[model samples]
Target: MKTKILFLLSIIVLGTTSTLKAQKLKKFGSSIEKKIGPKTIKVPYTDVVSYLGYAAPGNEDEVKDGKKFYYIYVWVPAVAPELGVRMMSPVGKAKTKNPIKSEAYTKNAKSKDYFDTYITLERSDIISADNISQDAVDSANWVILERNDDSGEMPKQPSGSSYNSLLRYKSDINDPLKALTVGLYRIGFTTYKTGEVKGTFLAEVAAPVKLPGVVMAKTIADLKAGMSK
Candidate 1:
């Protein structure tokens, strides 16, 4: 009888686990559909303008000099682009100026009007664009931005500008999403600089395109699993 009881308990646990996994995937599917697709949101136009700058990892010098900082663009569309009305920041910044072949990147990024060349505006802000840019109508990979101030101490050190751009974008876009819907996304970060670089990551996305909670959980799980293995 004890063995039979143990078997029954095992069956119950399996049933429960299976049910939970199905629910999780269902939730993930619903969330992904919302996020991985195109969408829009309502935001103070000022905040939208800030999204134009790319994400930064909040700077001591920026704060010291009083340059409002930002980067990292995530479109957690409340009702989404067609679903509802929302303001959009239309340009994307690039770590390199390759996509717009006609535009050339100048030697002095610090001294010149960088945005005029490297940064571009996309007609479309959707993921299929392959790169991020300044405008919504362009490619997904073109992250179009310039230092808020050319003179302030460099943000997130000199090497990690793209990463900072991603960060700023993510932080800026995420804030408005907290208010509504099962808002969805297809989020990522990549960066560029003027010169040839190796062993230098222009930028990297923080990971997991959907909910921050999901990203955090997966991160923790990956960490523990890595430590154990």
Candidate 2:
């Protein structure tokens, strides 16, 4: 009788642990649906824009900063003329100049005329148009921007004007997505003067993974053990 009781208790404990693990994993991802453009901007232009939904690792109310950004990764399988990408703020203006063609846009960027802010990769330098080869998609120029500033003011440009256009925001306002002010922002792509070629491109957003402190600690410990030679 005691053996049967012990077996049942073991089963109950194992089932509970499995259920907890599943719940923890689910908390790390939240589904989102957002897309913009494919509308013709000019009278004869057929500019198309499409966006892919990305899952952030937490609830919508979570605050995201420079350390924790909602990254957008773009892949263009074919090349086209006059292609440019920018992030549009909720107020219907380009928040930053095109990171792909920094030279042509630097004059405006320096004056803080068109866009007062910009985004850059946490890992690598922005991929410029000159760097992309015709044969393959340039993964190096993938879209990653810092979150917008909270001060409602344009960040001050540096002295001597050796503009690091990629670094636009003050350090304090680096967290662009705060739960209270979070809203849909557009990641735009323009393919100009290409008549009916039907070139392909993709855009996807990446949100950080949120895990409980205990779960995160265990994950770290496991990674450490695995890495130890």
Candidate 3:
């Protein structure tokens, strides 16, 4: 009788631990939808590029509406029908594939700090790859295509809230400015509320089609340099 009681207690404890571990590993990425007869289901993207970055003090690109902003420039080499962008802060034990890391991120990979992520996908007027000079980038007009403050699909933050950001923008062929043409784009990120944004983050950009030769950089000069290669 005593042995049976001990065995039952161990099974219950193991089941509880497994449940908690599974809950902690619930992470969602960008996805599309497919129809199977009378039902529709979402499918994750095949091509995903991840970037791990760190936002330190006094390293913001600009400040708007009393909030500090940072940007990651991306060069789209081909036209795509849809694009997806998402960001999560404090990048805790998350597994990523071949993620690009910045200098700050490499230096602070072990830092235990993060922030509430707010993100936007913007398209610039510079369309041609040959015209991606610094002068053109400086004079280019950028238009926001999508913005996300809190995403339920994202995993919960340390604060137990889904404050991460995710957005999917479909190209509008009717509108030239809104179309996803071969051009320059950027991922702008900041905090949802007015406060300092300091932490390690994982940001990803995905597309339904294969986007070869896509370049991502931390600044305009870096983006231009990548395009020149």
Where does candidate 2 stray beyond 4 Å? 1-45, 52-66, 89-117, 121-229
List the candidates ranked by lDDT, beginning with the highest: 3, 2, 1
* Model 3 misplacement above 4 A: 1-31, 36-39
Q: Measured by TM-score, how close is model 3 to the native structure?
A: 0.84
RMSD of 3: 4.7
Question: Would you give me the overall lDDT of model 2?
Answer: 0.26
lDDT of 1 at 109: 21
Give the per-residue Cα lDDT of candidate 2 at 95. Answer: 26
lDDT of 2 by residue, 39-120 (tens): 4322211232323122222412212342223333332222222222223211112221211321222323323222222333
lDDT for model 3, on a 0 to 1 scale? 0.84
Task: Give the range of the ten consecutive residues with the poorest summed lDDT in model 1.
Answer: 23-32
Best by lDDT: 3
Error of 3 at 165 (Å): 0.7
- The local lDDT score (0 to 100) that residue 111 gets in candidate 2 is 31
Candidate ordering by TM-score (highest first): 3, 2, 1
Give per-residue CA lDDT, model 1, range 1-229, as digits (tens). Answer: 9999999999999876653432221000111123334764323111111111222233211121233312223333222221111111112222222211111112222221122111111112343313323333223333332121121111222222222221122223354422233222322221233321111112121222322221100122332232234
TM-score of each: 0.19, 0.21, 0.84
